[model samples]
Target: MVNDDPRVSPEARTRVKDAIDALGYRPNIAARSLLLGRTRTIGLLTVGSTAYGPASLTLATERAVSNTGYGFRLANTVDVDIDSVENGLSLLLDQGVDAVIVNEPTSTFRHRRHGLAIPVLSLSEPLDLSDVELVVGSDEAGGVKEAVEHLLGLGHATVHHIAGPQEWPSSKRRREAWKAALEAAGRDVPDSIEGDWSAASGYEAGLEFAKRPEVTAVFAANDHMAIGLMRSLQRAGRRVPEDISIVGFDDVPEAAFLSRALTTVHQDLAVAAVRGVELLMEVLDGGREGGTIERVPTRLVVRETTQAPVASS
Candidate 1:
């Protein structure tokens, strides 16, 4: 009755249910897995910070897994190093998960042998691993292009950039895109200041930028950094969108509510999560092949933080 066996009589099932309810009984998931030959649990191995993007993706992926009537497990890695990634994967595999989703946005897994027996999906750039079944990522290049173009269209001679850690593939993509856009428009590409996807790092970068009087427009890799950069600029008596226009990535919930609302890129993390699970399910059902890559779209949200650069006297 606990296993929902149709062979059990209705009266027996009712009695068993009543007894279970009275005793607060719980079925043994391990025993169930032994009998069914499957755990019906999906595991997620996330690498890196608890930043808004990673955290939101984790929640969205969990919800998508739950909506499909499957159990979910999570394992975290302290860093994107090879040892940390392998340890995280081993933890998930030890849990006997049906499949694994690796939210590793770094290049640690590229061209490496994971030796995973179960299906694996990645939420980063497409990797050359035979064990990885699929790859799903956001259109970071497209968003960066839009932001750079918007700033250039506002008559800014060039747009400066505050990039995320160079180790992350997404950060590398954004930096490359920003550079490419500037080069394509015949604009001089300035050296980019790297941040650790933290507001403090952004503030530090902003302090250096504030010293450069030629900087009229700037784009931050993420909103947290943008917030810190804005504060530093304000402390230096530089008004946003007046002295230096600012653009940021990841349109977090607070982006629109800031005193000077952030103009940023919005990534559809929920859609990416749902599609990743859906593709993993297809792999589990033996209906899909490995090595498929999907890129989710992103949009630029124009807000108060961006405007035409003021004419210099």
Candidate 2:
């Protein structure tokens, strides 16, 4: 008998009806899993807990899963341990997770998805999505272009660049965009210094870059490195903006309150996390195997760190 009580919402009734329509039994999702080959649960693997970006992403992912009314199995690794990562994934699979979201950098996660029956989703960093069903990445190139364009709009000379490791897809994209913008503007594109996505690396690079007389404007690929670069420049007797302008990517929390402030590209990590979950859930919901690439937009935030290059006395 169909119960059409006023207290029961139509959506609730519809969900119950859908289950009945699927099969003659009115079993709960857990009971139906065996018959339908669905686990009603998701797995998320993330990087070290120490990193702010990854930690925030983990929280966002958990919230997304909870909103969907699905159980989640989460694992965090302190270091890049392939064995531990694989072990954690194996355990999640044992728990009957319907899909997996791997927050590891793309390159590492790509190789690990081999022979997995369920769909795998990768967030951040570029990877060979051949194995995984879908991958979501930040639009780093667009962010770099936006940052450079803002500096140019401020009447600064061509922007110099400090790039992260060449192997990281984000770093490569930002560096390419910076160079392309310079070429398009007919500005001299100096060779960019490399950093290891760390403030110390940025500081070291900044020290050397400060020696150049023509380096009036600089852009660092990530916020940590940007701060380090700024500090190094200051320690080397260069005044930000007044002496040489600077911009950075990532727009981390500290960017605004820094001594000179920071003009940076803001990559919306929360938005990216939500989009990644959306794409991953789409695949897990028996949708068509869609294209693998999903690119989230980025924004440029103007601050006190940038100004017109001062004329050398």
> Highest TM-score among the candidates is held by which one?
1
Candidate 2 lDDT tens digits, 1-313 = 2536888888888897888888786437776687778888989987665444567778888998888877888876655566766666677778888888878632554344355777777776534434446777688888888888888887877888889877555677789999999899988898899987889999998889889877888888888888888899889998888877888887888889987889898888788878888877777766747457788898889889888777667
lDDT of each: 0.89, 0.78
Name the lDDT value of residue 78 in candidate 2.
59
Cα lDDT of candidate 2 equals 0.78
lDDT (0-100) at residue 102 of candidate 2? 77
For all candidates, what are the clash counts?
A: 0, 0
Tens digits of per-residue lDDT for model 1, 1-313: 7769999999999999999999999877778778878898999988757899888998989999999878999998887788788788778888899888878766565336645677778887765544657888789999999999999999999999999988788899999999999999999999999999999998998899999999999999999999999999999988898999999999999999999999999999999999999998998878988888889999999999999989988
**Candidate 1: RMSD to truth:** 3.8
lDDT of 2 at 279: 77
User: Which clashing pairs does model 1 show?
Assistant: none
Per-prediction TM-score to the true structure, in the order listed: 0.87, 0.81
Error of 2 at 151 (Å): 2.3
